[model samples]
Target: MAHPVRSDAEVLSVASEGVYHRLVLSARDAAPRVRPGHFATLAVGGPQSAMLLRRAFSIHRADVEAGTVELVVAERGEGTRELARARPGDRLDLIAPLGTPFPLPDGPVSALLVAADYGSAPLLALGEEIKRRGGQVGFILGAATADRLYGVEQARALTQDVLVVTEDGSAGLQGLVTDPLAQAVKAIDATVVHACGPMPMLREVSAIALGLGVRCHTAVEAAMACGVGICMTCVLPVVGEDGVSRFVRSCTDGPVFDGARVRWDDIGTVPPDLEGAAAMGGQG
Candidate 1:
């Protein structure tokens, strides 16, 4: 892993996209270091507000030549609302290229990328990397409605096999994105699957891919008090290769991890079988 760079990035642009916002920042040192699934943390609320916790966002796109990084923001709370309101020329403290990125294949192979809502952010970048390496990529983007679905055109530009699903039937397909996942995987003869979304959606995507004997990688969305590893707020149960379950910090250990290794059902609570659960006061 590369060391993170902390710098004051100037807001290059904040363009509205339906209910989401695309934020471009001038991050010279950080942009060059970014990998597909890496994220960045920005101190929001303009220094005067009491909001001290930094807001973590996945790196939507990074341009090393342009010396810039982009983020996809959904205004779900005050912190994000502040970020969404940012205009050109404003500056914010930023730490970039944090967390583990989605691993690319050793050679060209067929792969399927899955996402929901703005979760498509990182996967879009991953698709570009895969294509650059001579691999074929497909995308499945889902959301509650048409407006919420992102990167439809972007996915189409990368690959002709882009699939969109919206729960309300306002888009490509009606129902969950997973409804067509298995078929899509088989159709494309996918060897690997990469996903980013809500926990439930990711769980289903992982299950579908693994059931079909395809390798799966998932980027999790967890609440973080600190984007760095200092806070324990984002710790979750994950089974290691040695078959022991331990609590790992999502911010540092991963925002990206093997889908099969994560204890999805045991998330948000320490399982009794965890390595230090008994000592940590868990009901063992």
Candidate 2:
């Protein structure tokens, strides 16, 4: 497990991405321990407001030396709209550096990074780390359209090997990122596949990796009223070492998990075989 930090920091900058924005902040306490899959809960409406729930975001990038953090946020709701409009000096409260990070490879090896739309937030840090260990990286970025694509250029710059895919044919390949994933993996002989995005995309990525006998790790996304473990709102069905299937909190236990271990086929609803599962409706 990684350490976490709670602090009130100043917004450093905001970069526009059509209706989306990349929100960056200066947080001395959070930047140090933050990892690739870690996330933060932000107080969106400020200190006093009817919108009491804090919004959760993946830690896009953090600099311990510079005391800063970045979040790639979409302006889809009131909370995110507020964050998008945040200025250079506005104070924002953040509980951060949460969750375990992607495991670093033992030695140099080729890798593939898969992302969906804005889900590219966490991959840059991971890509940098992979490169640091003398590994090569290839990317498969997917989106609805070219306008929806996030960090394509940044990804290209870092890895020098990226393939773009969109449903509207507005980018590199006109289709799902998975369309060319298996071929890409084979071409590069990627030994590991790391992904961060929608569950459906993660599921497909995992299948591809498993078919190729490559390891897959994922940072999953779930809707949550609270970003911590108490709510039980973001539970997932995962098999433990004991070979027992049980509900686990995505907020605490993982936003990241071994892709092969996740019960992907039964994700949207509860597992009927689980104990006491039927009493409460859809979960895990």
Candidate 3:
């Protein structure tokens, strides 16, 4: 893992994408080290605001030559709303290239990339990387509506096989992304699956991939109060190689993890079977 850096990044552009905002920052030192699934945390509310915690976002694109990093921001709260209003000349405190990145295949392999809404940000980069490595890539992008679905055109540009699904019948298919996932995986003969989405979708994707005997990697959408792993706000129960379940910090250990190892159904509540749960008096 490359050492993360604290940089004062200048806003390069802020473009509106339907209900979301795309923020491009001039981050020279941090741009080159970013890989697919790596994230960044920005100080919101400026210097004097009461909001102390930073807002974390997945690195959408990193342009080493341009010295820029892009992030997709959804204005769900005041912090993000403030970030959306940033002008091209404004500067923001940024700590980036953090967390484990998606592990790429050593050789060309058929891979399926799955994402939902803005989660499409990271997987797009992953698909590009896979193509550059001489691998075949397919995308399954889902959202609640047509406006929420992202990267459909981009995914088509990357590869010929791109699937889009929307919940409200406003887009390609009117159903959950997982509805046709198994058939799609088999159709493409995918050897590995990479996903970044809501917890429920990820859980279903993991199960389908594992059930089909294919490797699956997922980037969890955990809320990190401190992106550098200090606050323990994003720890979740994950089974280790030794078969012991432990509460691991997502900020450092992973924003990306082996899909099979994550206790997806047991998320949010600390399972009593966790390594140190007995000492902490975790209830069943």
Candidate 4:
């Protein structure tokens, strides 16, 4: 899809829920350009601007009929804090529909959607897409605690079964969310496993999916300065079909990637097998 229309989008509303803030924007053209995993960048600077950087956030929800798009943000810093303070009718500049989206299966197939923390944002739209394709969606969502879990209620409403877990046993299950992923996929007879969350969680999910002999896709969470690939800070190692691992920018190449194709173990440090990666310890 083409990039989202850059506009002085109006803030329709702002609401706060446990561990997250939901901001609704009156960007009528945004919905048409966005897909499930695509994200947005919002300029939070005001006149005589104290904060100059635009903040990137995942598109949590959208209502085309209502002419609006929503973002679920965790106010961990100044940029998001300013965004959270926005009121109705405030104008915010935005660039969106960024990055690749999760691919839909060629044929309708059962899926297991996994979410950690606020990662549930993308899966809601993905679930709708799955149902539209005559497929079923089963969810396995987890967080540090029940209050931190993003969309358990919504997931339950959309599908027949949802498994929720929290670290302290404050919610459905007591252990890590990954603890039940394999069993959940088996129970649903899922063909695909889709995940979005912290790198640690994604890594574990990828491993579990591989062990179960299922296809997996992941949406990586990276901090982007430009969100449009203008800055190269979000690059990571991705293995291509030619058997070469090259650094690809997550903002444009993907925030979403084929789980198997991503060089998971070599993500943080470039591996020697890569064609031109520097071998600091020894010269080949």
Candidate 5:
């Protein structure tokens, strides 16, 4: 699919549980193919509201010929609430095909994809892409319990190896997904590891990848007022090539980043202001 300009799209279906919704946009006019890991920003509310910014959501599915795109959004905030209230006929303004994609590893290699809870949305499309390119896909899904787990069945349909770990032992393995992921890495010769979930989970996966000496990439979930790089809300610490450290905008530089390149330890520790001298000392 060619990169098409952003346009207004209509809601196609709203699934049960208020977590997944599908939108159909005319992608024939889209300039770029909505590749795996790419996202789109949807504008909500009328001009009267102060919350005029667009909410970024990963492209769950894209069909260029049908001019359609789908997004699986978990209703969490005001923007998402408005989106959930939208009906099949409702139209939404969309800025799509945004951000860089997760790099597809070359050659026939074993790959591990990990997702926790709603984080599974982005990985679903990515799994399909990897399979299309003749790469073996292994999925490690983590959820608090059986009920919260979504898309595992779908993922299993796409890939032969699917492992599930629930916090409460309601279903699948009773533990963190990272446990099975660690076991998989040790048991198999995986070439790449890709993950998108909570910060803690990503950090754990990153550490494992580092220790294993394999390539790992993570898709970050940061709070953003603006989906584009205009706002500095989603700035993340990054290490430069010359061993220097800097902050990069997650909106533009990435929502996806090389796990080894990010300074995960100091991620949320940075002070917004220098006012908390005592707190800094306490942490030290």
Candidate 6:
């Protein structure tokens, strides 16, 4: 049954990956109309060493009737490691339904969804939503090798057109995912593009989109300490309304942004010294 609205609760569940983990909670109460390509902040820690910050994760799926939300997380760092150790029946705390969602194209459209690595999570729901809205959706997935390539089967199940590319040519095309993307863009008349992956890949895709005169949207990943706007940690440079370049917090305003409006070159070209500083203690 759909869980009714309540403050975000922590839930523990066993996943197919053989890990028992904690997941941030969100339901219809917080986002009655939550759409695809949106994310939330989850607070995860134990009582003694409770961390004060939240981790941002895109919603993998939202079941309004069931009042549940899901996310696909990889065990990467200390926080994620802790989450991986959670047992069934354990509870977790979360702040959810945060940040702006990807914009739906206004007219009847052919759309392409490009995802690299774990970035594919959000696109699943986005593709489902687009299909529900009567729009055609195609997907392109890229990975380093066969082992690293996850979600191909799931993405294939969700959309009829699925293209897979790997650096090692382990499974699909012999080249990078962008190769297939470039080909697909040329072969079809896609009206809009939605992509989430490594910055370098997105930059190239954005350039292609610009040349084609098609609208594109991208989701960016940055080092973020606080998932809310208060921390000012996940800042990216963007051009404001007046044409003056300024910084915007990715945790709040985005994680998703219009491809044409982003200062991609600046983001791709951070100075070595500044990059070092940010890696140490500076805000991105």
lDDT of 5 by residue, 174-199 (tens): 99978877678766577789898878
- Full ranking by lDDT: 3, 1, 4, 2, 5, 6
lDDT of all the models against the reference?
0.92, 0.86, 0.93, 0.87, 0.77, 0.72
Cα distance off (Å), candidate 6, residue 175? 2.1
Query: Per-residue CA lDDT of candidate 4, range 21-105, in tens?
Result: 9989987888777788888889876757878778888888778888788999898898888888889999999887788888886
Best by lDDT: 3
The predicted structure with the larger lDDT, 3 or 4, is 3
The residue-by-residue lDDT of candidate 1 on 1-284, one tens digit each, is 74689989999999999799999999999998999999999998876889989999999999999999999999999999989999999998999989999998888989999999999999999999999999999999999999999888999999999999999999999999899999999988999999999999989988888799999999999997898899899998999999999999899988998999998999888688899888898345
Query: What TM-score, computed on C-alpha atoms, does each candidate reach?
Result: 0.98, 0.95, 0.98, 0.95, 0.88, 0.85
Q: Which stretches of candidate 5 lie over 4 Å from their true place?
A: 1-4, 17-19, 22-26, 270-284
Q: In terms of lDDT, which candidate is stronger, 1 or 2? A: 1
Error of 3 at 51 (Å): 0.7
Off by over 4 Å in 1: 282-284
Whole-model alpha-carbon lDDT for candidate 4: 0.87
What lDDT does model 6 reach? 0.72
lDDT of 3 by residue, 8-120 (tens): 99999999987889999999999999999999999988788999999999999999999999999998998999999999999999999899999988889999999999899
In model 3, pairs of residues that clash are none
**How do the residues 1-284 of candidate 2 rate in per-residue lDDT, one tens digit apiece?**
76777888889898897546988899998898888888988987866888898898888999988999999898788888888889998989888877667888877989899998988889988898889889999989989988888888889888778999999898888999888999999989999999999899999999888988999999999887787788888888887777777888888888988888889998877787865677756444
Alpha-carbon deviation at 65 in model 4, angstroms: 2.1
